[model samples]
Target: MLNLSRLSTSLTKHGAHKIALLIRDHDPDKVLSLLWGKVPGINIEEVQARKNLSAGTTGLTVPSVWKEAKARGSETINALVLIAIIFSHHTLIAAMRQGAKSDFTGRITRDVELDGKAYTNFAHTLEELGYSTKHTQQYVDFDLQRLFKIPDLNSLALTLLALKMKTAGWDGTGDLKQLLIDNGFHEVFATDEDQFEAWLSSGKLTAPSFEDADYFLDAAKDSAPAGKYKFKAGHKTKQTGSVSVKSPLTKKTAQLLHNYIQNKFDEQLVAIHGRDCVGCEVATGLGTSIDVVVETAKLRWFYEIKVGKTLKACIRQAIPQLLEYAYWSAEPVKVDRLVIVAVHKLDKQSETYLQKLRDDFKLPLYYEQFVDA
Candidate 1:
């Protein structure tokens, strides 16, 4: 393995600002091209000579560079995408050497399909053909760190926005778009409307990339109220089979719930050696609007917060809603705990129904009244 610490340190010391600039200006592929081209800005001659010496064994390892790129934050991913805009084989090699994981790298390999037969080892082929990975062993251990957790872009976006707003103090609220732009979204997305529409259309917009970040969007919608970011309540209507109405909990509610869970249970759970879980899919299917899934205690927790006079109807339908969430969690999360946390204005009958669930099914069910305090 190359001396990763030395390489990383050298790259950071001499090339960090340049790499940051590359990310800011060009796509990731372009940045990779600069590296592969041994462009004038960063010293690649030494790196090139090293590759020339080791033509086999551990062909140029690029995963390590991407690990560094991601460490540099969203700016780098943007830079990588920019590189892809004007892609070439050299740039592709640069990207593979820098960001492409083995699996994704294979899909982009052009010459590997020998008469419609794909080659198994593209990275190795690239190495044999005068290409080398700049950062290698450093990233080999990355997969291990991700073994016990789920990744949530919603939480990340909120956290990033919160960090950006801290300078404003509690009184100073900031526009989420501006904050996202300041952080890096502007580079990834050329325009606000385009980005926002992309987000709405794909629902793939995350925090970093702003894809699927229901929590952040809800907060923005609430804070501005007039801005386009406000969280819109999902459609609701009366339904049969144990009365139901659509959940009014917007993305804002999701954020609040995330914080509530983290503040209340994160430390305690971690203390008890919980796996540090994230948003679970307790919904009925991938696209269906069922409910949020929270995994804990080796069981799936179904969560819905209900407000207004519709509490009774929501409570009646809660069982079926939870059952839907339970089925979804089975495959990806594999949770066994069944729980429902409902925040609603309760009636005597609704309170009784809540208890009946806890007592009869031996399930972990809870109810809380809507409180302004």
Candidate 2:
């Protein structure tokens, strides 16, 4: 995703190392060494060794769109153009937004066709963010490294390409002959000649779907985040006094964290309760939905998710929403407890504020913090 403000600082401070972290889950250092140590010209051993644990991986899932692309590729396209487009999308966006150079969409305007079309501001912020891992290294052997068993970057790229085309107004079934021109690298999308023509006319070729493409999956670990959770606060039984320090919030960074937190909370609830009883994003009768709702024979819980820099900010936003969701309608949804799920726990002062809400008004509201596991 194009969180350009923080991304600029991240790249300048850490080089490709931080971005590489988001692009891999299992021993990213191993991939770094392979790409850098093995090739001295582009070697980045020093970059690989710098340990900045704060540069965490993006928690995302593999969108189903890539599955269809992979399946259709056996006939029409090979891996090269597919891979080229990945780096292309990342670089092209960078070129347009961050003033970085790109091979496909040259320095602002070497190609007139894209010159009028490729301005950064014209693209919606969400469109710019889709399928991006915040950054991509424009290496020639991008496909080789992607095929080396990592799914984070590739999944993001194809989905990104689709967004770019949608912005450019290219049709899925449109003639791709103009796209088949030689940019000096073995003829673009020329992996299968006979099948390319067949696919061109057959209209079976598909682009990566935008749905769920925002997730950056950690394919190495079944989409689980690295490191054990530092602290957790949900109910008084599992609560802890300690809280996480404030972290930065970019538009893309916040969304990635929010989705990851929601999914993790879903898993935790299922483990504590049971799948049949736990419902996520359940729509209430009021036409609004709760992030995570749990129902047992005896009681029910309404959960609201809020990700913010401070516990106070999260609580302020979550409390009102939970209240309205629980009591807004005449036939209000049954709720024994109203819980708030957030990124950090309360500080002493903030904890006192929440306690007063409980003691004075006797609100059945509770607090919970999300941590990596």
State the C-alpha lDDT per candidate: 0.35, 0.43
Model 2 quality (TM-score): 0.35
Where in model 2 is the C-alpha error above 4 Å? Answer: 1-248
What would the per-residue lDDT of candidate 1 be over residues 215-288, giving only the tens digit for each residue?
22432422212211111212221122221223323344434443343233323333443444433222244333
Q: Distance from true position, residue 31, model 1, in Å?
A: 84
What is the Å distance of residue 272 in model 1 from its true position?
Answer: 11
10 residues in a row with least lDDT, candidate 2: 136-145
- Candidate 1 residue runs with Cα over 4 Å from true position: 1-275, 280-286, 289-291, 296-299, 328-342, 345-348, 361-364, 369-373
TM-score of each: 0.23, 0.35
